[model samples]
Target: MKRTDIDANVLIAAFQGEGEVCQRALRVLDDPDRKFVVSDYLRLEVLPKPTFHKKREEIEFMQAVFERAEHLDTSPTLTGRAYYGLEI
Candidate 1:
């Protein structure tokens, strides 16, 4: 894949060991050639709840992942389009 759009469910499953899908997603994430993309909405969505007690760790993990991949900040225009099921 040229680039992959990561969603909150994928991240949640990967972290929580909910299923094999998450494990597979993590493997794909480990690929050096693959580009991971996430919007600001995804950042908010993937972030663990404050009461989870692992907020710092989760944030660190997300930071490290983004540091290795391309980051696309969500703008108002893009957000609006995305809401209507359009690709950014």
Candidate 2:
């Protein structure tokens, strides 16, 4: 299985985008070989605003993704090494 970490924008697009963009996003999300690893950062980025505004459908969609995915605890050191090439 391929371990994958989806971006917030891609998740949003899957939920709300149109045409090819939406199709591609959904395809990635639904791939059987994928094992999604998600972080609280992604939840924070995608969930609160929709929940606060009472967008129930959108919230449910995001929650469904969260439910099917593996939750990962992100650390500043790991993020720094991954994204910034920092020796930590």
* Cα lDDT listed for each candidate: 0.66, 0.85
With candidate 2 superimposed using the best TM-score fit, by how many Å does residue 52's alpha carbon deviate from the native? Answer: 1.6
Instruction: Write the residue-wise lDDT of candidate 2 on 1-88 in tens digits.
Output: 9999989999999999999999999999999999999987787778867876888899999999999999988886755444442111
Over 1-88, each residue of candidate 1 has an lDDT whose tens digit, in order, gives 5798877776666666546777886887777777888766875565536224556766777666667767786688865654553221
Query: TM-scores of all models?
Result: 0.64, 0.81
Mark the 10 consecutive residues where model 2 has the least summed lDDT. Answer: 79-88
Error of 2 at 13 (Å): 0.3
Let me know the TM-score candidate 1 reaches against the reference structure: 0.64
Q: Which residue pairs come into collision in candidate 2?
A: none
**Backbone clash count for every predicted candidate, in the order shown:** 0, 0
